[model samples]
Target: MNKKQSGIIVTLVVLIVIAGYLATKVNGPLYVNDSDFNEKTAISLKEGKSSSTFFTEATLSRDQDNAKTLQNIKALIDDANTPKEQKATAADEYLAVATATQNESDIELALKAQGFDAALCSIVDDKVEIFVKSSKKELSKEELRGIQDVVMSKTKLEKIDVKIKE
Candidate 1:
């Protein structure tokens, strides 16, 4: 082999070795978008085999304070600007609207599924808002809308807004 060819071959060999070492030394894959880190890192940090662990529904009964709030909602709905005799007819719609407009369980589940720490929930002005915290991005608007739709179907309210902590 000629000297020039040997020199080029040696340079290429050195580059390959350096590249291999760098790749191996990397602690984790590069994350560019919010989701890139949220999904993958969340997956790694979670323990055990099931993703279900992260998505488990927040137990309502466990939170005595929120349970009392829910009781107050029942009373409010009873006294809402609607007739008593006609209440039965609107029962389905009432339940649907109230729950959809105020339900926070599903939202809690979604937040947990995404590996975020979510709180019980608070009902303000007939709206259900949840407080969530995490190193990752907060829950998305679309997700909250879906949960709201479920609760809205139970109430008399025409529209409801479900807010997530920022």
Candidate 2:
């Protein structure tokens, strides 16, 4: 090939290589073909803690929001004044609330994707613990009931130790 033709071909090859690298990096972890996805959260659950879906990608999405929530939850745990037992209890409460919110959101997204009109089920910490305004609202009674059933059923869980709130 002539010098000009060789130069053009070299440039095109370099560009193609760069483009191929970018494509692989972008699509490497999409899990499109996989049936399940899961990533570790900032706060590690207790050893016995259980989750509905073993591999969950929805919980992994909106990571920025999760980070902020985790920070706030940690602060709450730090701010609590009590004995070790009390602190542990408080931490468990916090985990339950946080996990419930994340789990509910993941469930909502999945349900919505499957053509179910879904809504956020408020995390029920306790009878006295009123929900703050930040929690997502229930979309409908039927959806809420459906979520309630799922949450209560204790089936399709990745772990067996985590207790479902009734």
Per-residue alpha-carbon lDDT of candidate 1 for residues 63-112, written as tens digits (9 for 90 to 100): 33344444554554577686776566556545644554345555455555
Q: Pick the candidate with the highest TM-score.
A: 2
In terms of lDDT, model 1 sits at 0.50
Cα error of candidate 1 at position 143, Å: 11
lDDT by residue (17-71, candidate 2, tens digit) is 9998899898784223223334543434233433322113223443444555666
Scored by lDDT, model 2 comes in at 0.47
TM-score of 1: 0.29
Error of 2 at 92 (Å): 0.8
**Where does candidate 1 stray beyond 4 Å?**
1-86, 89-102, 123-128, 135-166
